[model samples]
Target: MLSQSELLQFSRHIILPEIDIQGQEAIKSSHVLIIGLGGLGSPAAMYLAAAGVGEMTVVDNDLVETSNLQRQIIHQTNTVGKSKTESARAAIESLSPYTKVNTISEKASREVLGQFNSSNLTLALDCTDNFESRFLINEWSVANQIPLVSATAVAFSGQLAVFNRKQEDACYHCLYSNMDLPEGDCTDQGILSPVVGTMGSLQATEALKLILELEQPNGSFLLKYESLKTTFQKFKVPKDPNCSVCS
Candidate 1:
């Protein structure tokens, strides 16, 4: 039930024909687990919180570094030495007090995920920079039948895709054959500040769309964005039965 204050707070969202009170209520009830708090996770977390997700479990093992401030918007200069989870929690609280945030200062692993992986988990967002973490997150999402909104931003390129086990959609592993990725992450190759931010905002939009049950005519597709070219190309990802993770 939305309070009088919440009703006024989300009036713009409620007024939308697609996301009326029912959709807003669904957003309020959804619990999303976000892994990684770097460039992509930063905007995704803030947008989701402002959009009114009932609960968010933030997982990140790294500490906020001075270098991260350029891309990781959730962490500030005062929090440079603090844990990413704590910094993110503090930031989200300042923006949306009603939304509950659970901070996990641990690496993305089955042990950490087991504690929060439950019936209430609406979805999992892969904001990780490396392929290893993304694959692990995908495996967990597939095993638990949870939808995964995965995004990657490196250099001037970004990719966004939604994977659902219940929908028999292609899992994240299906997109990659070799787990070994050379020159992986923004650390190796440089990434533009807004390029990653743009992807993160889009990632949040996809999560809300899933919660609202928006129409996706493109059954199972991956969106690739090249900032330099200012072009977006969509490709279909077919599930591979031989894939180790989902199979």
Candidate 2:
């Protein structure tokens, strides 16, 4: 039940046909796991907080660097030396004080990260840069039966996907079956500030869709955005029949 202040705060969402009062309530009842506090996590967490998601567990091992200010919009210039999880938690709290935020400031080990399965976790946002972390998060999501919204950005290109452990869908592990793929971070390849922001914000949108049970978007859909070309493309990620993790 939304109070007067909350109803006023989310009036815009409640008026939309797709997300009226019932949908807004669903959003308020959700618990989301955000697996990184970098570029994608920045906008995703902020938007989720603004949208009134009930709870969030932000996981990050890195500290904010002066160089991260460009795209990690959740952190301020003053938070440069702070842990990413703390920086993000503070930013989310400021946006929506009623939104409970939990911080995991160390490496996202399987034991530590998977512990959140004890809660009523609704979904996971995989904002990590490396495949290893993504795979680990995917494992947790599959094991817990939680849907996952994953995204990545580098230079002018970014990609997003919403995956679930459904018969027709490919999990993140199915997309990267080899596990030996080379990785590139924003430090080496570089990213346009808005490119990452765009993808991260979309992660928040997709999470909302799932939370509210809107249209039931296929879990295998893959969306690509190119800031340089100003184009968006969609594709289907076929599930690997022999996927080691989700098969």
Candidate 3:
């Protein structure tokens, strides 16, 4: 039940027809796992906390660098030497005291993933920059039948997708399995700050909808954002019968 203070704090959300009191309650009860606390994870975690997700487990091993301030909005100038997980937890707490945040100041290791309480974890958000982290999160989500929201941004472009193991959705491996693509890093390639912010916000939106079951979980989609052209393209992705991860 929402307390009087919570009701007032989330009055805008409660009044929305799509997200009424029941949905607000659902949001209040949901727990989310956020992997990575850099460019993409920053806004995703911030918005999720602001939206009143009951609990969030944030994982990241990196410390804040001076370069991160350009896009990693969750961490401030003073937190440059601090752990990303701790900085993110502080930011989320500042945004919503009602939202509980668990900080894991380590890489998303098997041990870390193993500790997640499956029953309490409503969704996992993949905000990591590399393919390996994304793949691991996808594998974990598929194995546990948990929903996953994955987003990436580099060089003025970004992509967002949601993979639900319970539904006939395309897993990340299904889409890029045979494709040979060079690994790109934000530091090496240079990324527009807002590009990641845009993708992160969309990730948060998709995670919330998936948690509430607000949208039909049909096939998945890969949404591409081109900042140069100011165009958004969405391509439908089907689950591959031969997908080694989700098959």
**Which model scores highest in lDDT?**
3
Number of clashes recorded per candidate: 0, 0, 0
* Best model per TM-score: 3
lDDT per residue, candidate 2, 13-97, as tens digits? Answer: 9999999999989999999989889999999999999999999999999999999998999999999899999999889998998
lDDT of 3: 0.89
lDDT of candidate model 1 versus the reference: 0.88
Tens-place lDDT per residue, model 3, 35-74, is 9999989999999999999999999999999999999999
Q: Runs in model 1 with CA error above 4 Å?
A: 178-182
TM-scores for candidates 1 onward, in order:
0.95, 0.95, 0.97
Candidate 2: list runs displaced more than 4 Å: 178-182
Better of 2 and 3 by lDDT: 3
lDDT of 2 at 224: 90
Model 3: pairs clashing at backbone N, Cα or C within 3 Å: none
For residues 111-168, write the lDDT of model 1, one tens digit per residue: 9877755486998899987777887788888778888899989899999887756555
- TM-score of structure candidate 3: 0.97
